[model samples]
Target: MQEAVIGLSHLFMTVFLCCFANFMVIPAITDVTMAALCPGKDKCSLAIYITGVQQAIIGLGSLVMPLVGKLSDTYGRKFMLTLPITFSIFPLVILAYSRTKWYFYAYYVLKTLIAMVTEGSVQFLALAYVADNVEESRRGSVFGIMSGFASSSFVFGNVSTRFLSTSATFQVAAAKSVIALLYMMVFLPESVVKYRTESTETDCLLEKPPTKTWKLFKTLPSVNDIICLLRTSPTFSKAAVVAFFSNMADVGLHASLMYYLKAQFHFNKDQFADLMIIVGIAGSISQITLTPILTPLIGDEKMLSTGLFFSCAHMIILSVAWAPWVPYAAAMISIVATFAQPCLRSIASKQTGPSEQGKAQGCITGICSFANIVSHLAFSPLTALFLSDNAPFRI
Candidate 1:
């Protein structure tokens, strides 16, 4: 009962804190990029470059995710999870306190490197923990609840940004993560045990003893391990494909949306924050109510694909938004489109046996990291060029 409670609470708070930090940062990323790269006018190109550079650095860091995931398999989740979360703290504080261009550069380097260790894995680890604990048939609802936790927290984060300064938001976000780290250290239990370790055959009685804490640091899974899993597992392969494309769209959207909207619609921070709040509500409500009902009825794959189709629609609507209200209108698409990621995660978790969940989720995270590099680079330049005065279309 205590373990269950810990897992549930951990997921809820971790999702909330992560979403809070994320929402806190979304409005600021563009501004920070501008401040770091170009103080006055001519900010667009440098901002784009900063965004691309950040993603590229994180992409390099992401190479460790699969290894970390596999390490969770060998060393255990608690050790794997704690180090990244600890590494995460200082960077947030550094970013919050940034006053100079050099501070910005330091923040960027620390963020890119620190985040590479935890970026794709935190939520993945939480989801993997769910898979470790819950029964197979009911995992979708749990995943949805987790997603809803994120969205709901995003709603709160948006509210904070409405009144708070960028520095305040970053500080509060850092504090929230600190609370989470303390909570995990005190209460969270290891979901994986020696007897329950994943293996190829049934009646698999082979379980390696937990590696020593120092030894855990050196035990890293290679890129080949990730590739071999993809090559060997058909279900994992298909899920990886869906995750790749879906993340391509998501990463591209995240990197470009704020810059695009502010450039075209002249949205200030408050306006951008409100748009996100609306989108969050739409997703939160849907994932909480609609996805659970739909996942069991239509199946995760079909539901995921449907969500992706609507995601494409959401992007298209944003592209040609003619009026201020149009962006808000596009937010309604999130009602259905919110199903994509959680569903993909559920599908992937279901494909793997108990032992392989960490590896699988880590691979998905690695795919996301790779896609982030590509999408940020691709979208930053394109969005900048499109919004430039010299552009042909004049968006």
Candidate 2:
């Protein structure tokens, strides 16, 4: 038990570092895009279109995330975890060196390519790692705790960004990413020992066995495999439905919110950081404290519903903000709204056995990735239209 806790602590530290590196740049990226693509303009159609295109391509690449997860079940979480963290560093280095128009385009291209593999893989792998070590009964709280660490990192990253210059933010982020990768490589232990043993035995059983590399690819989860997994459990299917729409709303809000704020209120990087800090602090408190207490009492289902309801409320408030402070007020809703993901993930994790945790989480993440593609397609145009001078109707 002590060993498990120690392993989880290492995992949490890795998550915090990686997330801090990633989130620190969110506020600065918008300004960079605006300056590069449309200098002095808050609303840039080119920036929106480019972002949409990049998101679409990344979503398409993320379809392979499940494959990586499935492979982690055969390999090890520590090994799989290294790939994304390492890939994440390259784009940040590019941006750290320069944020000029040509350099921004270079960063954009590399970032899109890297994000396909790096985006959701870290979180999903971490969740699967937790599932490997945690008991079913305690999975919800543990998942919440893990998310809380990420939220804390989000808050810290944004706070750092609030003070750092734009160039310094990217440079610091790249450094942190390197640190995260190294820490994981050195400290995090493998969690799938039993699965690795089973895989070895299975490999030995084959007559004139193929290479492990070929077998790994051959065993990649297919469409029918995902379908079977979904149809095999009613609970999982319901969770899949929730995951799809929840992620759809999330991606839409993420894609539009910063641009909307910049256009609607002329928010700069510091204002963006302030807004994110509110959401992060609220989310961190809810996940770290409220979730563990409330989930067991009210149940994950009720918690999920409560979260989704408030998530909608917050988005509605943001859409119709009368004052700059309204967005900050709406961000407070994340205190409860943040309950959605950990609960949803907990419920999903319960549907699969220990050995299949990676596959199951990957499938769920793939569903969310598909939602990202759809949300980008639908929301990007609307955001561009509404934010542009010639809008069909004003909000």
Candidate 3:
């Protein structure tokens, strides 16, 4: 137990550094995109459309995330985690070096390509790692703690962004990304040994031949594999439904919200960072303090429902936001809404065995990726249209 706690502490630090690297650049990226594409204008159809395209392609590529997860089940989680974290650094390095128009375009293309693998894989693998180390009874609370760490990173990153200039933001982000990768490699221990022991015992009992290294790719989970896993329990199927729609809402909000604020309220990088800090602080406190207490008492299912309810309320509030302050008020609802993810993840993790953690988490993440594709397709054009000067009908 002591060793497991120590390992989990390392995992948390790795996740914090990686998330900090990613989150710190969000406000800067918006300004950079607008500056490169539209010069001085806040409402840029070109920027919106380009962002939508990047998101769509990333979603298409992320359909392979389940395969990555399955591979982690075979290879070590540390090895698989290393790949995305390493790739993530390159995109940041491009922007850090220069934010010129052509350089921005170069960064855009590379970022889209790399995000396909790194987007959701890190969180999924981290959850799988936690599952491997922690038992089922305490899993929900532990998941909340993990998310708390991530939310804390989000707050710190945004705070950094609020103070730093755009160039410094990306440079610091790139440096942090490198540090995250190195930390994981050096400090985070592999959890795959537990799964390997289980596999070896089953193989010995059945007299199974060792799998060849060349055939590893052939063993990737198929459509049927996903279908069968979903059918494993009714609870899992319902959780998948929740994951899809919840993620869809999230992606749609992410796709439109910043642009909407920029267009509607003339919010710049500082304001964007402020809004994110509000949400992040709320999320961090709720996940760290509230979730651990409430999850055991009310259970993950009830907690999930409650979280989703608040999530919807926040979105509705944002949709009708009249004043700039309204958005900040809406952001505070994340205190409860943030409960959705860790609770949902805990529920899903309970439905699978020890060996299948990666596959199960990966499958759910793939569903969320599909949601990302759908959200971009459905919301991106509408966002561009409504925010553009060429809007058919203005509110």
Candidate 4:
């Protein structure tokens, strides 16, 4: 029963709220609030500036995650895990009330700060729960089940946001987040053993003197060991690189794919929502159906590689902007990528010590966030250069 609870604890409805709120708002605002944020004569050019700012903020979060990891080590994990979710309230409130460029600036800065918190404690703590409670062999399956639940929210949230009024849509998301908070307060159980020692030597040493707080951070494997681990451990590097490039493809798509559809097909709110739903469906299916079947056959290493291959292929197809089945093809590629993500995380978990799960996951996610920042910075110019109306592809 405890195992079952631990497996399901991480999938609070609020996890969906955290991501869905951004998805529902960002794409729509790329033309509106983002334009206000930029306030230039050219709307698309303005969006580039907004993207740059957002990426800069996300990059800041990536920079701050190591600190959050250090805090998780010293202060405990639960509070840090809950901090970001509460911090999300500011942006949701701003989105509810704001109407001007200054509001956009204030809101963006605040949201960026809070968003950083999610990577270290917010995400890691839940996985840490699994690490504490679940046995070695079953970790992958538990993670898969969690991913499926978490990914399902994307499908529903996208579909709901498409039909709901702007205020109502954001309100529902806020409500979902509040409920997730309540659930965590009441039902989520912590499984980590406080003040654990790996062996008798540490136990005796603890009797002699307590270790300095800084020592915990310092005691982590040296830079050389990290390199050696990566060089010999194909699994970690494979998972990390796969995660990086797959996220890069996603950033490229999110940066311009909606605009592409709007330009090519005259898609409106409802249609855009439907297109997003398709992507979510494909992604959820990947996490739900594809990874389970493929992981066993291809193994985690090839699974990560295969996922990256399909995701990159999809991005290539999207960049071409051909007619007919472009959206569907892109959706299929994302599905495969989402399917493989858990496998990557599971493989990564297998390579690291149980005590360092929070730090390891934090590092992996930090790298992905860095990749996202780089892609966001690069994609704006790339899209402007390749897909802008003045360019050769004008159509």
lDDT value, residue 330 of candidate 4 = 68
Which residue pairs collide, candidate 4? Answer: 286-339
How much RMSD separates candidate 2 from the native structure? 3.7
Q: In model 3, how large is the Cα lDDT of residue 330?
A: 90
Taken over the whole model, the C-alpha lDDT of each candidate is: 0.76, 0.88, 0.88, 0.61
Tell me the tens digit of each residue's lDDT in model 3 across 1-395. 34555669989999999999999999888999999999989899999999999998999899888888777776768888999999999999999999989999999999998888778899999999999889888888889989999999999999999999999999999999999999999999898434333342112121222243757857587887778777756788999999999999999998999999999999999999999999999999999899989999999999999999999999999998888899998999999999999999998988776777787899899999999999999999999999978899875
TM-score of each: 0.90, 0.94, 0.94, 0.82
For 1-395, candidate 1 gives per-residue lDDT tens digits of 23553458765776577657666767655666676677764338667767777886787689567777767766667767788777777877887887468888888888887877778677888788788787778788788878888889888888888788878877887887787688777777777542355454212211344455666545665556666777766877888887877888887877777777777677777887889889999999998788878888898888888999999999999878898899999998999999999988997787666766777788888887887877877887887788787776766
lDDT of 2 at 223: 76
TM-score of 1: 0.90
- State the displacement of the C-alpha of residue 330, model 2, in Å, after optimal TM-score superposition: 0.5
Name the runs in model 2 displaced over 4 angstroms: 1-6, 193-214
Q: 1-395, model 4: which lDDT tens digit per residue?
A: 34564456544444554555555664355444534754443335556656656765676577555455435544455655667767666676776675477777787777777776564345555565565566655556556655665667767777887788766666666676666676666665544534344442112111212233556555443445445546655667777786677777677677766655655665555666676678778777776566656666667767666776776787777777678467765676677766566767787777655455555566577667888788888887766565455676564
